[model samples]
Structures are given as structure tokens and as C-alpha cells.
Target: MIICHCQSISDQDIRAAVDWMRAADADTIITPGKVYHALGKRADCGGCMPLFLDTMRQCDSFGVATAAERPPILRPARLRLAQAR
Candidate 1:
């Protein structure tokens, strides 16, 4: 399915870009702009954003990871043992 008509980006393209990005850098954040760049395209009209985002969300790699879900808290285990502090 075409997600961004202006860029001719499809759902597979988006997923491929996302997976490529994730593979390139696990800690990197994925965005539509990056996907466009990866596919060597750009956004024209802003109209496709809604469907674009919907398609993006369908990817398995499209959500916040557990570590990024919330800020860490100061604790004895983290500060003394794990040193995550």
C-alpha cells in the first residue's frame, strides 16, 4: 500500500527503511524524514502524514523500547551495584 503518494513510498518501503535503520543503529530513533531520506525521497504535501504515521506504526520496530519508556530513578542497586546511577 502506498503510504506517501508524493514520495511514492509504500508500506514495504517504510518497513524496509525502518528495519535498515534499526539494524544500522539499535539506539537510533526512526522517523518519517529518515525513512524518506533512506529511500532517497522527500515529503511534498503534508497531507500524507496521517496515513504515513499509521503505516509506520504497523512496523514491529515502531514503538519505544523498555529502557526508553521512562526515566531511571536513583537507587541503591543502581548506584552501588549496577552503577546505572
Candidate 2:
């Protein structure tokens, strides 16, 4: 299940990278570039992006939690007033 032919990356490699990244930093956003970096490889042709993204999406720890799962950001009252003005 080679996902990126240019980088010789397989589905397993992608999954393993994703898992490792999630374990290392639970809040870090996992992207294709990060996956490539984690695997010590880089994208060459850009043709595998579709399949690469698909494989990444299939991983259990591939995505970050929705806004609901995290605390809402708080802006200063002065900033809010400035924006309103």
C-alpha cells in the first residue's frame, strides 16, 4: 500500500508516523508535511497528495479535536471594544 511513490512511503509508514506524532504531542496538528518530516522524507511530485491525504485521514489520530473539545479563546475586553468601534 504505497501511498507516495516519490517518497517510498507506505500506508503503514504514514500510520506509524501519525501515531508517533500524536503520542509525542497530543495537541499538535498532523499534516502531510509533518508526516513527511516525521518519516524523514519529503514530497517530490505532488501527484500523490490525494492518496497521501486519504491515507492520513484514515489514521485514528490523524485529526485535531474540534473547537468544542478545547476551551474557547478569550480576547481582552479592550480588543473587543476596539473591534466594535
Candidate 3:
């Protein structure tokens, strides 16, 4: 279940990274670059992007948070402005 042949990243690696990221910051947006950084690797080719994203989404905490769930920092600027006012 290797997701990225170029980086030698497996599905398990992706999942572990995702889970760790979720645990570290529930409000953080998980991306391929972040995953690569987490695993101490770099993206060498663009071919694995689609599959990489798929594997990331498979994780339980891999989507945009609802309005209520979103951290204040992640809220839309307009929403923040309204709240501030």
C-alpha cells in the first residue's frame, strides 16, 4: 500500500502522519507537504498526489471543520470581523 513510490511512503505512514497531525492540532489543515515534512521526506514527483490525497482523506480527522468546530484562527475573515464588532 505504498502511496508515493518516489518518497517510499506507505499508506500506513500517511495514516500515522494524519493521526499524529490531528492529535497535535485538531484545527490544523493537513496537506501533502505537511505530511512529507512530518515524515522527514520530500515530494519528488507529482504522480502520487491524487492517491496521497485519497489516503489523507481516509483518516477520520481529515476534513474541514464545521463552523462550530473551527478554531477562531480558522474562521472566515468576515465572520471574525462580525464577531469582533
Candidate 4:
């Protein structure tokens, strides 16, 4: 499934790039521009953004690398702890 027609980027390519980026730097922020840079291309137009974002979120390793990286306040337990303090 092609995600970005301008860059000739496919869903698989995006997945691979996402996995590679995650593996390379667990804390690194992944974005469409970064993916395009990784693939040696660029976004020609804003048309593919919706599908592009969907494919990116579908990736398994598509989130923060560790529990600490996630927003602590977002967790109920942590929220309670913060309130306690």
C-alpha cells in the first residue's frame, strides 16, 4: 500500500523506517519529515498526510521507548502520586 505517492513511499517502507528509527534511537521523535529524510525523499504536497499518519501509528514500535518517556501525569497511579506530593 503506497502511502506517499510523491515520494513513492509504501506502507512497508514506512514501517521499516519507523522500526529502524526506533531501533537507532529509542528516544528519537519520529515524524513524516524524518521518515522522508530517512528514505532520501521529501513531501511534495500535503495530500498524503492523513494516510501517512495512519500508517505510522499502526506500526508496533511507534511510541515512546520506555515508561519514563511517557507523560507521567497521564498515568492514573502517577497522577495520584503527584497529588499526594
Candidate 5:
């Protein structure tokens, strides 16, 4: 269950962080760095990245919703620029 040994981060911790971040800002993109920051920890060794990412993916709130799922106003700048062109 421990995803990052260096940071003493567990799968549950990752999930909780992800959930909290999503709740705080629904449109914010969740990343490993953000998760670490949310947990008040930082990555030491780079080895845990693979497992860390896997754990993040398993979290329900980990993935950002696709353009179709998000409101038009919330779409990324690139998408809006493409549309404008």
C-alpha cells in the first residue's frame, strides 16, 4: 500500500490527496507533484514514480475530465484557440 517509500506515502494518502484537490478545485489537473504537495511531502528518490503514477491513476478523481465532459467555458486554452482559428 505504500506507494512512495521515500516520502512514506501510501495509496490511501494519495487517494485522499487527490480527492481533496478535486474537491477544492474541480478543474485543477492532478499530478504526482501536486499530490506530494497536498500531502505536505516531496519526492526524494525518483524510483517510486511508476508506482506513484499507478496509484494516482487508480484514484477516482485522478484523471481530468475530457473536453466533452467539461463545460465549454472550462475547456483548455489550446482547444479554445483551435476553435477560434
Candidate 6:
């Protein structure tokens, strides 16, 4: 279950970090770097990146917010005027 061999990170560690982050800030975006920082570690070799990303993707709160979930996009005044005309 070790995701990062260099940093000695486990699947449990990843899950714990993710849960803690989500609890701290629901809107906060979780990434491998943040997870590593949360665990008081950092990525060493670039090799573990793929597995690291896979483990992160396994987490429930790992995806970006959908358009409907995000705030409405606003158009620039010039663009709006052009469209209106």
C-alpha cells in the first residue's frame, strides 16, 4: 500500500491527509504536494508520480468542481456589449 517508496508514504497516510484537508476546508483543492506537506514530507524521485496520482484519484474529494458547482462566470463589459449588438 506504499504509494511513494522514496518518501515512505502509505495508502492510509494518503487517505488520512485527504480526510484532514477536506475537514479543514471543503473548498480547498487537494494535490500530491499538499498531501506530502500535510504528512511532513515531500516528493523525492519523480518515479512515484504516477502511482501517487493514482492514489490521490482514488480519494472521494479528488476531482475539480463541476461548472454547475462553481460560481457563475461573468463576461467582460466589452464582450457583453458585442454580444448584445
Find the candidate with the highest lDDT and give its number: 3
lDDT of 2 by residue, 1-85 (tens): 9888888999999999999999999878788999999999988999999998998888888764443343234345555566558
- Cα lDDT tens digits for candidate 1, 33-69: 9888999998999799988888887888765644435
- For each candidate, what TM-score against the reference? 0.73, 0.74, 0.74, 0.76, 0.74, 0.72
- The global C-alpha lDDT for each of the candidates, from Candidate 1 onward, is 0.77, 0.82, 0.88, 0.86, 0.85, 0.79
**C-alpha RMSD (angstroms) for model 6:** 6.0
In TM-score terms, which candidate is top? 4
Q: How close is candidate 1 to the true structure, as a TM-score?
A: 0.73
> What pairs collide in candidate 6?
none
The better-scoring model by TM-score among 3 and 4 is 4
Query: Candidate 4: which stretches are off by over 4 Å?
Result: 65-85
Which pairs clash in the backbone of model 3? none
- How far is 31's C-alpha from truth in model 5 (Å)? 1.0
lDDT per residue for candidate 4 within 1-85, as digits (tens), equals 9888888999999999999999999877789899999999889997999999999989999885455556665446865576569
lDDT tens per residue, model 3, 9-60? 9999999999999889976788899999999999997899999999998887
Candidate 5 structure, TM-score to reference: 0.74
Comparing candidate 3 with candidate 6, which one achieves the higher lDDT?
3
Task: Report the candidate with higher lDDT, 1 versus 5.
Answer: 5
The model with the greater lDDT, 4 or 6, is 4
Model 3 scores a TM of 0.74
- Prediction-by-prediction clash tally: 0, 0, 0, 0, 0, 0
